[model samples]
Target: MKILNLFFIGLLVSISSLASAQSDAEIEKMIVELHKPTKKISDSIGKLMQETKSKIETEIDSVVKENLKLRSDTLFNAFDDNAINELKQDFVFAKKYPNSLAALKLLRRHVNRFIGMNFYDTYVEVFQNFSPEIRNSEKGKEMAQNLQYFKQSKVGSTAPSFSLVDSNGKTISIDDFKGKQYVLIDFWASWCGPCREELPYIKELYKKYHQQGFEIISVAKDDKQDLWKKAIEKEQIESWRHIFTSEDNKNIIKNYNVNGIPHKVLIDKNGIIIGKWKGSGENNKHDLQQLLKSIFEAE
Candidate 1:
């Protein structure tokens, strides 16, 4: 049993590692080897395991084929204008196959794109189309929890509040900025490459807007305090308030729907969220900068 298990595990790993580079026939052969039935097991248990293994292999193959098709899809490649059509198709697939792992994987892969493009309502609809059993699965539970956080960080929702120790050892909360200044709650970490790349641009925004009742509260997700402080000093962004997430304070990440860094939430003086940006893409940077200009320049 041990040798058989190890042989199957090795085959699965080989399939995964070579799937992208393998020809369709070669990939199929590897998948077949991965799920091949063992002669050592009793007939009844072997039959059951074979059925389960066949189902899992089918799911994996379907997902892989769909992904390969997507790689060559020109319309989906264009993305900005044609993404909605593809997303609609994915939603249809999800609804039709409510319990399919392949369907769930497709949804999970595109969720960030959906959220980024302001199609959050459609994303929720897709989630609702899944079966109750699928919805209660572990992955489904995570998606459900994330949906609540997304609602809290929606553009019109009030910013979620939190208190954490700052670089100067002072306790700071989003509530402290309410009625006094517009705030940008930035979720980042010391080790994230994209987060490090955006720090200089953010520093300029802080410097430009600080006098105009603008403030930044950078929430570091670093597990190590020294790394957080070192990154701050290295980036020369010590002027803005800095804090880190800990086992005790990590709920701040969930409270803001921070699926990825560097996630940012912009709030007005009254604490109403004006914008929520994720990732370190050029478009995100431009949008945040343009909105800042509109607010402060108008005043």
Candidate 2:
């Protein structure tokens, strides 16, 4: 009897161990099922992110196309005198597409080009009122530079000093004539037609006022020394000192802020600039003559 009871006790112990092993395997399977759902959720999120990105790109492309079309239409309508007015009207449309990079680019281009066509003061006012970040952009830098250069080219500013070699290879500096009553600094080129046309009038003025302490300094922006000499001879501009500068000489040009040819600066004896003349129009000639006469009378 005792042997039979021991055998039964051992059999019961083995059965209990088998039941515990089965329970552990079932728990592991439950854990794996929970992890499977997590992986599915992760994959779903990734697919959704890709779809969202594609949608955003497609929308951006569509906005760009529309903005380009609008710009084209606006430019086409800008052929008339009412171009500025039309541009102002289209600015409302540009504002509507705020935050669109394509629209902002188009708006900036049109605004900058329009500013070039009008008063610089107005441009400055408008640009200053714009978004600060946008105004500091690369395009904005160029616009500001243009405005500054234009402002510096105005009359009554101190004429920039320069030194160049005369026809005899003697160095001449604008400061050399500082003690005189007045000085006329003329920028000319051998190939400039208007400069040649104005030579006779300049000669007349020099001959009349030269003895009265008036001096003329003609600076030639010429690449060829022979052509420059020939022009000086042909024009009979002998009373004035003639000097030539090389084609690559940018310092003088930048100092004067000269963008066009036939520019003249009138300076007082104290090295202070009094007036400026630009271009070769009839109005410019008349203005120059009047100014010279006024200066002579004042002296």
Candidate 3:
């Protein structure tokens, strides 16, 4: 009886061990099946990422090519409905996709020409609408610089302050004239014919109004100091202040929007730009003369 009981217990132990081994094998097989689908999902994600990258590169290249065509001088100079339409489209693209590389590139490349062609307001509006990431980029910074004059030097805006060396090696600044006198800021070059022609009229105005709290600040764009001094002496009008736009000071030209020589800005005693003239002619002279007469002769 004892031998039979021991044999029965041994049989049951063997059966339990076999059952445990089979359960482990089944779990291993389930793990392998789960990993098969996971591997396929990972491979699909990698392929999708590569395709997305390639598509972005292609789009960037296409945009750059189109921009090159739009930047041509002929297209900008056409000044017709087609040119206007093209510009309008560019503006629309930039406004709608402010963060796009192509939009930023377009504004950076065409900002100067757009301002020159009298699209200043529109250019400014577009630039202001860009995202901070776009506006703070290197190209965006350059665009903002190009728009400086249009934004700061317009009529009814305060004149941008700057400093330059006078003939005596003395530094003079636009702020020096503020609150003390009404100032006429003249932008002239020694080689400019129109500037030379306007000298007599400027001198006459200075002589007539110098004692009445009026002052003239002549800013020369001369390449040579001797020529500038000679012109001053030959004209015998050195009674007023003279400033040379030296290499470091040439930015003043851009600040005042000196599109052409013989440009003049008239500022009141409080430093407000009261008048501006671009070129030398009877009409400009007449305008300046009348403005001065109205101010000093008002009393």
Candidate 4:
């Protein structure tokens, strides 16, 4: 029922058996009291020793997963705006209580999305401020690499370029739209459910900004052209340009260093990479929405 849901229900990795963090006496007491198994829904099961934090959190997570009961269902539900917001809330807790066993559990569970929140500097700060052991551990080193990539791939980086073909077999490149219109290079595919789910967002952005000099190019990584075209038609993605990506021609993915699908790269009129986002997280949607607002409303 809480945001710790991010690190649990739809997150990753093995849970580390944890003890409770050292909280103020009142908070520690409260945390203990809040989780006790009892006649009242709010009863504390037992006193929390340092080791109790990990066990309690893991137990709670197990209950959550059992309640959800289906991994596919959990993933499907976790990509929308509501889910995104919940994940952000969990990240907030993770940031605020970085040293708390619950926060540590959440961070490791949602490591990919936590790093994906690089748009929000506070999350980065949480990583920077983690305890010496955690911050210097293997996970920490991986996070550091992710942070570096996130920083370099941010808004204002040069948009990478490549040549590909549209639906009609017309060759297309970023150069075509550079200096003329704002372009959104969408990296997606037909078989990707999350990518399909995100088409409406792109359509909405196009409808709002196309008359104001916005254009879009889709790089489809679909091996099956029939399925790809059907999905585009099914989604009514007729207004924008569509390009088919060959296995030997995966520059859109390789050049941008995209690690996931449904990745959106926004470029300004001059072809400067204005913003980029990857993942189905709420913060990712928010970042794109904010970028759209700034672009269309700007002087």
- Per-prediction TM-score to the true structure, in the order listed: 0.69, 0.57, 0.58, 0.53
lDDT of each: 0.75, 0.65, 0.73, 0.66
Ranking by TM-score: 1, 3, 2, 4
Tens-place lDDT digits, model 1, residues 1-299? 99999999999999875763354344335434532432122344445545544554465578765544334232222433344555566666566666654566567766664334476787798889888977898988877876777778788988888888888999998899888999998889999998998988998999999999999999988878989889999999989899888888888887887767888889999989998887766667888999999999999
Q: Please, what are the lDDT tens digits per residue for candidate 3 over residues 227-286?
A: 999999988878988998777888888888676777888998778888877665555677
Spell out the clash pairs found in candidate 1.
none
lDDT (C-alpha) at residue 254 in model 2: 64
Cα lDDT tens digits, model 2, 49-164, are 45544554465578765654444333333332244544454454335433333333434454334223334455455556546555676766665676565555445555567777
| Model 2 poorest 10 in a row by lDDT | 72-81
Best by lDDT, which number? 1
Which segments of candidate 4 are over 4 A away from where they belong? 1-152
Clashing pairs in 4: 18-54, 19-50, 19-51, 20-50, 36-44, 36-45, 37-45, 84-282
Q: How far is candidate 3 from the true structure (C-alpha RMSD, Å)?
A: 23.3
lDDT computed for candidate 2: 0.65
* Winning model by TM-score: 1
Rank order by lDDT, top first? Answer: 1, 3, 4, 2
lDDT of 4 by residue, 1-299 (tens): 58897769544433233223334333445434533422132122222222343444465577654543343233334433343454455566556654554454445444444344434465577676677776666766766665655554567777777777789878888888877898888889999987887888778888988999989888888999999999989999989999888777875666675677878888898878887777664456777888888878984
